[model samples]
Target: MPSDYHHGVRVIEILDGVRPIRTVETGVVGVVGTAPDADPEVFPLDEAVLIIGSRTKAAKLDTTGNGQGTLPGVMDAIFDQIAPLIVVVRVEDVEDENEQISKILGTVDATGHHSGLQALLTAKTSLGIKPRILGAPGFSHHQPVADELGIKAEHLRAFAYVDSPATTVEEAVVHRNLFGNKRVMIMWPAFKVWDTPLADYVYQPASARALGMRAKLDNDIGWHKTISNIVINGVSGLTADVSWELQNPVTDAGYLNANEITTMVVQDGFRFWGSRTCSGDPMFAFESAVRTGDVLADTIGEAHMWAVDKPMSPTLIQNIMDGVNSKFRELKNFSYIVNAECYLDPELNSVESLASGKLWLNYDYSPVPPLEQLGFRAKLTNKYLVELLEVK
Candidate 1:
């Protein structure tokens, strides 16, 4: 049947133009450690990688009898503080430190199969998700793993949380100075945390706790804030409390802070008391600055993926510049940056270069630096009454 429609009816429509940039997920942690159920026959050790969303999922995969090389503790420590997604890469458990290191850095077999760290790297590539933070809490105080993870982080444009094999402040500072890289941050002195299933306090790496704290900071606030002076949850006490005042000089804490090695101290409760990267370059020494720069770079890179292989016209270039400048202005409005400038010049985008299908973009910005030092000044005055009476 046919019917006549009502006259003078109005219809409204909306259109979306110029796609905005997408914000990348921050503080996703990638953990490589040992798990009993990660056997070759059960979970295919060569390709053993899982994304755990909650503590319950982690408990199911933790088949270790004594809860060693298990993910429940780390998961509990992380999820108890902040809710961030985690990727778990399980490697075979070995007693010998050298053998474990060897396994993590896998070698190609006759059948062209890789194991251990190599396998995890392969899985990471295949999964197509890059975690912004990396940690390996199961391998306590293992420097080799930290080194390899630092290399991976440099390639992946991420950050790593490394644990120093030192129990005292002096030893930790010495150990931290051995490696100088911007992508890694060193933590010291394992802490004892109560385990419900074990009914006892077990010492665990401080890197796990640091990772959780960073995650919480990212969730609660922006990445421009430092992770220092924040209380660490899920821990009772440090294995050895390193005092900043008892050192050779009272200023040794400043030295430790300069070296990028953070320590646990007793305040009202245990707290993380430093924020710096292991980079020798003083420009990027602060961990918060490094993270903010990374976030900016990643966001810009992902946002420009749509312009690839497009026509190299002036309109196209202007569109790209406008999009980038818009994002930076938003950051400035949010107080993440002092100001940002982006442009392309003839020197960078020459006629020959443009003809050869090449384009260049240059941007500069300053991040909000953390207040590592605070000072207060006071002056004594004797004529307070006379000064007050003369104001009118």
Candidate 2:
């Protein structure tokens, strides 16, 4: 505080205005599942344990050859795509299959302990990172579990990848009807990979592969980029033979994508073919769009901690506005947003609200959506030949 009673010559550096906001990583995956053979000391029941770019101890996550647990194989699948931070919440692997579903769904005990999907809520507080990408791998195929995942994703400003039954394309469409949420994307069939532990080929859930793909896209590329069309590695084949045609929409791959169920396709090798979420709303159809919005909102919101409880002044208000606009430009340069503008509206910030030290800053941004379709009319005409004849 500068007072009138300040004696001689003293300098007060006024620090108020736009400061670059900290950008949170958008690729941290929080997965919930069983790890029957995992060291209980390492991955306690219902505790959020962080694993960063290492699998020395991850081997302990399962030793029974992926027989009882889900997390072991899923972790391997995610690591196959890209090494990103993973927050695992392990639950008890019970005898009853239905009990395993309940465990994966998790519960907040009366003592305030979080388990299952609920354990992800404490990821930020306990592990200093929030998982913006989430999944349950084997368990997410269960409708209730997937719905619960959607609920948790909304709370954490995260996105969830859910698996679908591999029975048929129609079954995948029916699975899509089981859930509809912008935060949740449904993946169909499963990916087959060589399981050295079992000396046989086993299927991994599409949701688990999606988790890895998303992490790679966010880390290697910008978060605004789409997860589709990228070549998937460490996969031999898909459990279902998803047909795909470059210029046709009447294929199995196209049908699954049309119904908002993401399926893999074989191109040069195998590629993730779909970009749509389970959302019925066209506005949030694409996972890339949802993620772009999440990153912007989370980064901007977390960056404003310095402004809290500070004296509101014109300089401070201007600083806030400029900070947001500047961030928009930076993100636009990185292809995170198409374009963005920030402004203060008098209608939103009323005189009374300002008097009460509340000011409303408004900004709008358009996310870069995935290119699902591209078309150029192939007109067979003499027009091009006429030009060629003149040149000759």
Candidate 3:
């Protein structure tokens, strides 16, 4: 019998490539709240982690009417306003409200248990995703929850959209005074959502809606655009109608603004009418500036990941600087930033530091500030009479 023989050969190709800096994904929101038992079909609920991709999946996991129903409502609000990617972290259900709050605050030991807010803090390790925006929706009103989220956002280089615990404008002003973190944006006076089953408009935290609006803003315009003055779509109405006059500095809204709290008002529609962070520092007062800085830091960090193990040399430093400068040039061209530059100072990056395998990079960028105020001057003049005489 004749035997058939075959010869096998394999080819391998190696390509040298430099990974260019990329803009991190914006508008991805990380939500931590309570959910019913996990549906194996939708997501591994038992794992207490889910990255919802569609409104249908969100509806399936909707816990809108449960005791802790506001979580689903927040999710629905986000979906209604804008279709941003949502990462849901479902906490363990406990009967006691106090115990639940403690669990969410991460006060209780999470060993062999599903930690609530702690889950979100460790989402990158557990779920393989990092959200640019973080919120607890219904829970953000709680001081502890808001504080924890603010700390997380600051540490993770993200933004925290929080709601004031105040039910009235007056209370919101007081609550706003308690916060002063650039990473946090406190929204006041929840909006009314029409409940289908109850056939009534129920008040819900505006943080969810604000996050959705910010996501929409980032998607529609660049991230540097101010989130204020935009219509908050998919809301029946604000819980309370705040007048434009009252929003002035001498009024409640003004005080709230001083404390870094944003409020919505009834205009042509329910509009997000403020844009400032809780940071007491005037340098980072504007939310857009804070956000732009965060985006730049994240983008630069990601871009330089490849330089970690490479030998530290002048060429390596120049290459890194060139890449970052290129990105900043694009951003400046897009008007996202006024100007930006990257360089290494000889004093900062000394021979000792280079010998020790340490490199120093100086990055400076002027973010486009929001036009929060405008002034007009009027004068009566007779120039029109001269022009008319000349014409005659």
Task: Pick the lDDT winner.
Answer: 2
Higher-scoring candidate on lDDT, 2 or 3: 2
- CA lDDT of each prediction against the hidden true structure: 0.74, 0.86, 0.76
- Candidate 3's residue-wise lDDT over 116-172, tens digit each? 666565666776667778888878888889999898788778888998887677888
Clash tally, candidates in order? 0, 0, 1
Using lDDT, rank the candidates from best to worst. Answer: 2, 3, 1
Clash count (model 3, backbone only):
1
Q: Give each model a TM-score.
A: 0.87, 0.96, 0.88
Regions more than 4 Å wrong, model 2: 1-3, 63-68, 383-392
Clashing pairs in 1: none
Candidates ranked by TM-score = 2, 3, 1
* Candidate 2 CA-lDDT value: 0.86
**Candidate 1, 163-279: lDDT as tens digits:** 888767788888887788898888877888998768999888888877778878877887777778888888898788566643333454556676678777776778787888899
- Candidate 1 stretches with Cα past 4 Å from truth are 1-17, 37-52, 107-115, 119-125, 244-252, 385-392
lDDT of 2 by residue, 1-392 (tens): 67778778989887875798767888899999988888889889999999996776666687655545888888888898988899999999898988989989989989999998999999999999999899999888888898999999999999998888659999888778877799998887798988877889998888888888889988898788877889887899888888889989999998998888878888898888888887778888888888877887888889998998898888888998899898888888877789988898889978888888787788888999877889898767776666766754
CA RMSD, predictions in order: 6.0, 1.8, 6.0
Global CA lDDT of candidate 3, please?
A: 0.76
